[model samples]
Target chain A: MAVVCFMVTMGLYFAATISFLAYLLRRSEALSKVSLGITAAGFVAHTVALVARMVGSSAAAPPSVHEALSFFSWMLILVFLAVEFRHRIHVLGSFIVPLALVSLISAAALPDTVPTLQPMFRTLWLHVTLSMLGTVGFAVAFVAGVMYLIQDRLLKSKRFNVLYSKLPALDFLDDLNQQSIILGFPLLTLGIITGAISAEFAKGAYVSWNPEQTWALVTWLFYFVVLLGRLTVGWRAKRAAYLTVIGFAGVILTLIGVVLKSYGTVS
Target chain B: MHVIVVGLSHKTAPVEIREKLAVPGSRMGEALTRLTSYSGVKEGVLLSTCNRVEVYSVVDDIEQGYGRIQEFLADTHLSLSSEQLTPHLYWHADDRAITHLFRVAASLDSMIVGESQILGQLKDAFESALSHKTTGLIMNKVVKKAISVAKRVRTETKIAEMAVSVSYAAVELAKKIFSDLGQRTVLLVGAGEMAKLAAQHLIAQGVGQVRITTRTPQHAVDLAEKFGGTAVPFEQYKDDMASADIVLVSTGASHYLISADDVQRAVTVRMNRPMFLIDISVPRNIDPAVRHVDNAFLFDIDDLKQRVEKNRAERLQEADKAEQLVVEEVGVLREWMKSLEVTPTIVALKQRADEIKRSELDKTLGRLAHLPAQDRELIEGLAASIVNKMIHGTMVTLKSEVNSSNGAAFVESARRFFSLEAAPPQDTRGESAVDSSSCLAHDMNAPLVEQVPSRTASRKQP
Candidate 1:
């Protein structure tokens, strides 16, 4: 049942991506509504699937790459929907929903083993989940940054229809970038702290200095500096938007390092 | 009845030619009266808008109806000779006319496809025809169905959702930038006509405050009074830009009035808040480099015009989708019309059955002349009930089949199999005869139902 629901969630996400893309071309309110509804439905299915997986898998098993990726995409959509409803930027889905699909597709490409979660009854799972959500926040900022660049280009180039009309305002995308970073930074701080404490619990050392651990700290510092710049001097979205890409790079590297480590242990 | 449409639209004739042949609203009743006065026309409607002038009518003969409507068109617009008018007028008859009406109502045939103005115009024209009493059962059904088809197109296709006009495009862009125009302030620079129209549009969108500035102080002051706002001196407009969220510049001056440095300084004064600059002047009053300024978006007239062009292209694509919907609805209306044609046949078949039953009952009764009165009454009831039950089944099946795809074929076969056309439903051996038997042959101009409406009110002495 868990596996079936997981596939169903993937299918719903695919449909949502297509609908959002279609809405971009047509620019109709009805299509936007339908696209949002589909995304909401997909989010529901994702939650159900995750709950079913938790119910099915044994508690002692550690987190697999598949489960981590699934939760990451799920958290991204959760934040995306909250922002969408608050702002009513229908076009935002065109920029964000496809990223969810890409994440889900990556997860699907991995093995179908039900990832029960981490460290049995230990707090290490908290560490994994928090860090994953922190990465999701950065991913949201990255998507917003990408949109800002595209809108900025379209405005500067004087292309005033289709994609230009369908995109959110430059200022709105900029504000969103700042807001997501502001939200994500604290979670990332706590996420790193929890990871350090859990490292001490699991391997009897506070600092493991492993590839994933090093990458996570580096990514955290990068976003910390970014948040400081935005808070202190009130930097524009374009600069922060361009800078978020480096933080996103750190996220990708950390995920890769963890997945490789998990494969070495599981196989 | 045959439905015919004769008209000219923006596609066929230039506005100059259309204006010469146009009929205004005040003359609609008189024009419709003259239209139905023609020998072939039985019911009529005249639609006159700036883009097109058309006449929709039900007629006895398609060819002669077109000729008669053409004659009426010629009579109304004597300034334009037949040589000039004949080249522009288009005529459609029967099902094609219905399809044409649907397309027009749905705005597929408009100067700007997917515009909603045509639908309102069509409804107004239809209402005029309704009030003038120029419409009967067929015209009413066709026009009403056309209106519904237009509505269906609007809901089923995203044709009219986007703005295709330049002024409307500006508002759409503003909404994209600001999300809410209610708190935004607009600074109007120069008083060009088109720029003022756009400013009025922005004001209508509930922009917070409007400030007008022009080279002439009196014109600025008067325009400010008209717009319910204050006017600033032309030299002091730059200071006003700091508080303004939107600035519209249109002047005949060859040099750029608002330069990149000015916009840069304004953004600083507003603490980097976004400013929307629109330049509609010929030489362009705002500097193009203002777009490079942080949070400043500048659009010239050509940019808005380009946006309008792109929006028009998008609407045309949606128009294709709307056209498909219209075609589907036309099929539905055509099926309904075929069923309407079957009503008369259904009535005729029942009448023939009744005549046969009565005649045979008379023969049997004459043979049993010495039978008891009670037994004769019993026999009469039995024969009437049996015939009624049989005809009821056949009529129900016939009515049900008339709306199907091959309904016309079944109706034709039923007419032939029952020999309904060869023998009219009147009893030849009886004293009473229906003098309206001429209506039995399915005359296109004749009433489909049994009751012929008194159309005398529709045709006056004029």
Candidate 2:
């Protein structure tokens, strides 16, 4: 039953991706509405699968690496849909949904392990979920940043195409990038602080610098400087958009390292 | 039974000749009356605009109708003779005339392919003819169908979506940058004519506020007052750029009026908000390097013109789609006209068959007059059913054959075979053939044959 539920979730995400692809090829009001509807359904199915997994786990333990990956994918979709609805950024779905599909597929292909519940893992789950949410926000900002550069290049070159006609203006994309960063930086800071506290409680040595923690701190500092530059020196538009794209890369690398380490510990 | 058009437009006639033939709005009633007064002319509409003057008439004979209309036009301008005007005029008969009118209404034949003015002008001409009572059943149907077809072409095709003028092009570019202009501000510098025109277009597009600045403060105030906007002093205009989403620069100064430093300062104040600067002046009021700023987009006169030309090309491509739609509609209208011509012959054949059935039934009943009442009722029912069965095949054949090429000749032969009296088809119908408004009404709703009137049998109102 769990396998069936997970397969359904993957299938829904794939269907939504196809709709978004059609909307990208030929811009139409009907097709855009359908894409949004399919994405919303896929998001609901993902939530159900994640909840089922958590309930079936031994002693209601926190999610393992595979389960957590699935949950992270779900969080990414939820944040993207929230921003899409609030800004009416219909074109952004064309870029965001395919990334969500990739994450879900990876989650489905990886093997799951039912690790014993550790006493300190509950506190660790809180920091892990918060970190996942922060990375989700940065992923959205990364997509917006890429769109900004493409639009900027198209306008600067004076080459008009179908995609150029459909994409939002550079200003809108840049603003969205900044807003996502502003939303993500604080969550990441809280996530890192809670992570250190949990590590101290579990191992009695929170000050030891692990590679993942070092990378997370570096990623957080990058965004912090970016936000500061934006506030103090008006460093936005192309410059800020590029930095957000780079910062998101740092966040993703750090997440992969953490997920792989957790998987190794389970094995 | 034929649609005829005879007139001169921008294509064939010089402005002097067209102006001479044009009937102004004040004289439209007189022109329409004269048009319908021509020999063999049944219904008429006069369309007179600055670019073209045309008379569309539903007439009996195309040859006589064209000659009469040409003479009428020459007489309107007494300085010219029919021969002198004939060289500049072009005439279309039947199917060609229908196609021409549809193309005109759809704006395919316009000087600018997708211009919207011609449609409105055509509508006004139709309403004028309608109000003058010079149009009857056929003209009414044709005009309404033309309007509906034009509307379809507009919605189904993108012929009118592109901007062809420089002022409109600026607004189009602005919309691409800003989705909603309702809360955006526009600042006009120099108060020049081009700037004023662009500002007006921006206002018409629903920009929030318009501020004008000029070398002479009074001129700025006067221009701003005309558009219901505020005027800023020339010295303070640089500072005002911080609040503006779009700036139209058209100063007469030879030097660059807005430098990169000025724009950088404005960006700092606005926290890098996007600003669109349009330089319509030949001397280039805004420095081109200002475009290098973070959120500044600058367009010069040449750039706007190029964009306009590109859009015009796209409109031409879209016009091809609109023309195809017009061709299809014309074919449908041609089929409808053919059905109108065959209606009279069909009605005559049915009437003749019914007369024979009634006479035969009377004779049979008289011969069986001594029969029982039940036997008499049985004979009447059987005879009526036989008559209906005989007429059904003939009615179906006639209706289907009306769409064929040799339909009129076929209809004529059928009339003669039934020993029916032959009359001119156009004169058979009241007012005009093709009172298709009734047919349209029937098709639009419940399919009740009771509402289908024998319009061809009625006489023309005296």
State which candidate has the highest DockQ. 2
- Measured with C-alpha atoms, the lDDT of residue A130 in candidate 2 is 75
Per-residue lDDT of candidate 1, residues A217-236 (tens digit): 88888888888877766455
Q: Please report the candidate that would top lDDT against the real structure.
A: 1
> Any residue pairs clashing in model 1, and if so which?
none
Worst 10 residues of 2 chain B by lDDT: B435-444
Q: What digit string (tens of lDDT, one per residue) describes model 1 on residues B1-462?
A: 578999998789876677667776557789988887777687887877656889999886799888999889988888887778889999998889989999998878864456565665665666668877777656776777777777777778776564236567677667666766888888888765446767888988898888988766776787799888779888899988998988888664546788999998888777566778888665567988897886788888778767777556666677788888878877776665554467888887888888988899999999999999999999999998898887777678777875443344466567777777632111122211111111110111222111222233332211
DockQ of each: 0.22, 0.24
The candidate 2 chain A region of ten consecutive residues with least summed lDDT is: A113-122
Q: After superposition, which runs of candidate 2 have C-alpha atoms over 4 Å from their true positions?
A: A114-119, B1-165, B305-462
Q: Write the per-residue lDDT of candidate 2 for residues B77-190, one digit (tens) a residue.
A: 898778778899999988898889988888787654555656666766776787677776566656666776777787798865542366787887787667678889999987
